[model samples]
Every structure is written in C-alpha cells, then in structure tokens.
Target: MELITYWISILPELGNGVINTLIMTFLAVSMSAVLAVILAMGRMYGPRIISTLCKWYIEFFRGTPLLAQLFIIYYGLPSWGLNFSSFTSAVLAFGLNSGAYVAEYLRGAVQSIDKGQMTAGLAMGMTKFTAIRKIILPQALRFVIPPWSNDVIYTLKYTSIAFLVGAQELMSKAKIIASFNFRFIDTFVFVAIIYLILVLLLTLFFNWLERKLKIPGFEIKN
Candidate 1:
C-alpha cells in the first residue's frame, strides 16, 4: 500500500523520464540508421580503402561492449579535449555501437542479391553506380527489414545504459526514485514491467510489418 501510494505520487517524475528515454532512443536510432546505410554501402561496393575502413569500424564497435564504449565517451574523451554533455555522450555511444550491427545486417542483405541483377541493369544503359542505386538497393531493403527491426528493438533496450552516464532516462528515474524512497524492489519491478510492455508492443508491430511488407512470390531468404 505504501509503495502504491509512493508510485502514484511519483508518477509524474517517471513520466518525464519516459519522454527523455523516447527522445534518446529515437535520436540514436536515426543517427545509427544513416551511418549504418553509409557503412553498409562502403563495405559492399566502395573502393578498397573505403571497404577497409568500413570493415575496421564494424569490427571495432561490434567487437567491444556497449557499456565500455559509453564509459569511454562520457569519461575518457575529456582527457583528449573532446567533451560532450551526458545525453549527447549516451546517444553518440549507442548510435555508433548500434550502427555497426545494422551495417552488418544491411551488408548481408545487399550481398544476397543476385549478381545478374546488377549486370542486367548495367547492360540496359545504366552506369555501374546507377545500376547499384536503381537496381540493387531497392531489392536489398526488402531483405533487410526484418533484421533492421531487430536492431531497432535492441536500441530501445540499449537506451537504459544512458542513465548510467547520468542522462536521466527511464532507468535513471527509477534509480533516483528507489534511492529516495528506499523501495528498490517496487521501483525496479515497475520499471521492468514498463520495459517488457514496450518490447512486446514493438515485437507485435514488427510482426505486423513483416506480414504487410512480405511479397507473395518473392523469396526473401538469402
């Protein structure tokens, strides 16, 4: 009863945290998506130097943990004269980390397209670059949708790490509340429920999206 009362009274604070969380997640994912596309393209068709750089980027980020990266961004960069606010650090770290995985998924999708597709476009008056832009990418996007959705969901969960860097997202809100009220159990239980509900809704949305976007005759498994 006491926990319930406290929760009711503190709901507004938590609500603000939710808004912050959503902002972080959206910004991070948007940044990650753009970087991911560029990295994916670089790995797939760019010159050897571009491909090597892209490969190194993906390997470095995916090879390491997100928490470590967040810490380095928030704590370590100041020594090098690169400074960022808490929220900026979180978003930058999460976006760069997520972009690596997204690049791999997109690159795989791009590679799965038949070589003949590009060839056919080239034979029909399209330049190689035009053939890639007009012919290859369109087909690759369909195959990437499912995996890309997974990355989005992962990014939603990843926003929790922002709080550790003092970004004031949902997890940070819960931590502050729990410390003040000394109600760790109740606070975290509620937080877990909120996270669970969000993930469930996202999963359902992706499922619906897959069904809607799936073509009847196009076999996407490559």
Candidate 2:
C-alpha cells in the first residue's frame, strides 16, 4: 500500500523523465532515418569507393557495442576538445548506432524492389541518381516501414543507456527516485511496465502504418 502510494506521489517527477526519454528517442530516430537514407543510397548506387566506405561504416557500427560507442562520444571525445552535453552525446551515439541498422533495413528494401523500376526511370532520361531518389527510394521507404518500426522501438528502449552518461532520462530519473526511498524493485518494475506500454503502443501504430501504406495489388515477398 505504501509502495503504491509512493508511486502515485512520484508520478510527476517520472513524467518529466518520460518526456526527456521521448525527446532523445525522437531526435535519435530522426537522425538515424536521415543517415540511413544517405548510407543506403551510397551502398546501393554510389561509385566503388563510396560503396566500400559505406559498407565499412555499417559493419563497424553493427559489429561493435552501443555502450562503448556512447562512452566514446560522451567521455572520450572530451579529451579531444570535442565535448558535448550528456543529452547531445546520448542522442549522437544512439543515432549513429541505429543509423547502421536502419541503413541495412533500407538496403534490403531497395533490393527487394524490381530492377526494372530503375531501368524504366533511366529510359525516361532520368539520371541514375535522380531515378533512385524519385523512383526507387519512395517505394523502398514504404516497404521498409515494418522493420524500421522495430528499430524505433529499439531506440526507445535504448534511451535507458543514456542514464550512464548522466542524462536525466527515464532510467536516470528512476534511479534518483529509488535512491531516495531505496525502493529499487518497485521503481524498476514500474519503469519496465512503462516501457512495455510504450512498446505496445508503437507496435500498434506501426501495424496500422504498414497496412495503410501497403499496396493493394502488389506485395513484396519477405
């Protein structure tokens, strides 16, 4: 009963944390989407050198630990005189890390598109780059929605990592609250419930989006 009351009383503080978490997730997801488009374009259509560089970049981020990336951005970069606020560092780290995964999702979508689409665009006098941007990428973006939604959920959960960087996001706020009352179990359990709720809501939204964007007469094979 006391625990329940305590939870209710602290809702305002936790709400602030939730806002911060949402901010980080929103910014990171936006950055990741932009980077994903650029990286996917480079990998699929750029010259050999650009393609190779994009490949290397995707592999590096995918191969490494996100936590390590966050540390380097938040901590290590300070010594090099390129410092950022904790919130900024967290956003950058999550964005860069998520960008690699989102790029692969986009690349797979692009490949699933018919090769004939590009040819049709070029035969109409469109440059290869223009054709890709106008003809191929729009279709690819629609196709990529399902997998990209999963990435958004992942980013939302991953914001918890920002706590280690002293970003006062959800997990960080939870920790501060728990420390005062020494109710770690209650605090974390509540936080987990909050996360689960957010994930469910996102899943529902994406499902609706996938259906809405789906072509009536065409389907892409998974």
Candidate 3:
C-alpha cells in the first residue's frame, strides 16, 4: 500500500517525464528523416561531391558513440559561441546521430529496386528527380518502414541519455524519485516495465504495418 501510494503521488511527475521522452523521440525521429533521405539519396544517386560529403557525414556519426556526440553538442559547442537548450541539444544530437543509421537502411532499400525502373521512368518522359520522387521513393518507403520502425525504437531508448545533460526525461525522473525512496530496484523495475510496454506496442504497430504494406513477392526481411 505504501508503494501504491508512492507511485500514485509521483504519477504526475512520471507522466511528464514520459511526455518529454515522447516529444524528444518524435522530434528526433522527424528531423532524422530529412537527413536520412538526403544522405541516402546523395550517396546513392548524387554527384561525386555530394556523395562524398554524405559518406563522410555518415561515417563520422556512425563511427562515434552517440553520448560522445551529445556531449560535444551540449558541452563542446558553448566554447564556440553557440548555445542550445538542453532539450534542443538532445533533439539535434540524437536526430543527427540517428540519421546516420537511418541513411544506411534507406540506402539499402533504394538500392534493392531494379535500376531498370529508373530507366523506364526516364524513357517515359520523367526527369530523374521526378522519376525518383514518383517511382523509386514510394517503393523504397515500403521497404524502409520495418527497419525505420526499429530505428524509432532505438531513438526512444536513446532519449534516456537526455537526462545526463539535465533534460528531465523518464530515466532522470526515475532517478530522482528513487533517490528519495532509496528504492532503486523498484524504481528501475517500474521504468523498465514502462519501456517494455512502449516497445511492445511499437513492435505490434510495425508488424501490422509490414503486413499491410508488404508487396506480394517483394517482402522485405528487415
């Protein structure tokens, strides 16, 4: 009963933490998408200059630890006369970091489609941009969805790092509450359960999406 009362009392704080986590995840994922499309397409289809730049960007992020990058954004940038709010830093760092991984997934999807499709579209009077926008992207989106869903889940967990830089996300909230109660195990279990529930729901949604969007023989294995 004491535990129940404790949880009930902290419900509002935990709820807000959940909201911040969700907001961070959504914002990061949304921004990451722009990077994903740009980087994926640039590397796959653009000129050597664009492709090289994209490749380097992808390597820099993908090769480094996300926390290290977050530290640079939140801590290192202040020395250069740049400043961002903790939340903003978390969003941008996480988004850019997630984008690197997302780009590779999207690139594979884009590459899987036959090159003949682009040729056919061009022959039918479509410009390269129009052909990709119309023919390549639609099919590529279907293929990327499953893996992108995984990326979303990954982003959700990564938001826990936001707390390290003073953004009060779910993990931060849990830490605060646990510190008071000295009930670390209980607090961790509660947070873990919440995370599990969130992931389970996301997995179900992605499974349903895959079933609905999958082409007959073109079923993606992501």
C-alpha TM-score for every candidate: 0.94, 0.96, 0.95
Each candidate: RMSD: 1.6, 1.1, 1.4
**Pairs in steric clash, model 1:** none
Best by TM-score: 2
Worst 10 residues of 3 by lDDT: 2-11
* Superior candidate under TM-score, 1 versus 2: 2
lDDT of 2: 0.93
lDDT of 1 at 107: 87
Q: What's the C-alpha lDDT at position 50 in model 3?
A: 97
Better of 1 and 2 by lDDT: 2
Candidate 3 ranges beyond 4 A from true positions: 1-5
**Candidate no. 3 TM-score:** 0.95
lDDT of 2 by residue, 90-206 (tens): 999999999999999999999988999999999999998899889998899998888899999999999999999899899999999999989999999988988999899999999
Off by over 4 Å in 1: 1-5
lDDT by residue for model 3 (1-222), tens: 876776777778888899999999999999999989999999988999999999999999999999999999999999998999999999999999999999999999889989999999999999999999999999998889988999999999999999889997999999999999898887787788889988998899999988988788887654
* Per-model lDDT: 0.90, 0.93, 0.92
TM-score for predicted model 1 compared with the true structure: 0.94
Candidate 1: residue 214 Cα off by (Å):
2.5
TM-score winner between candidates 1 and 3: 3
Candidate 1 residue lDDT tens string, 1-222: 987787788789888988898889889889998999899999988999999999999999999999999999999999999999999999999899999999999888888888899889989999988987888887887888888888988999989988888998999999999999898998988888888988898899989988888878876754
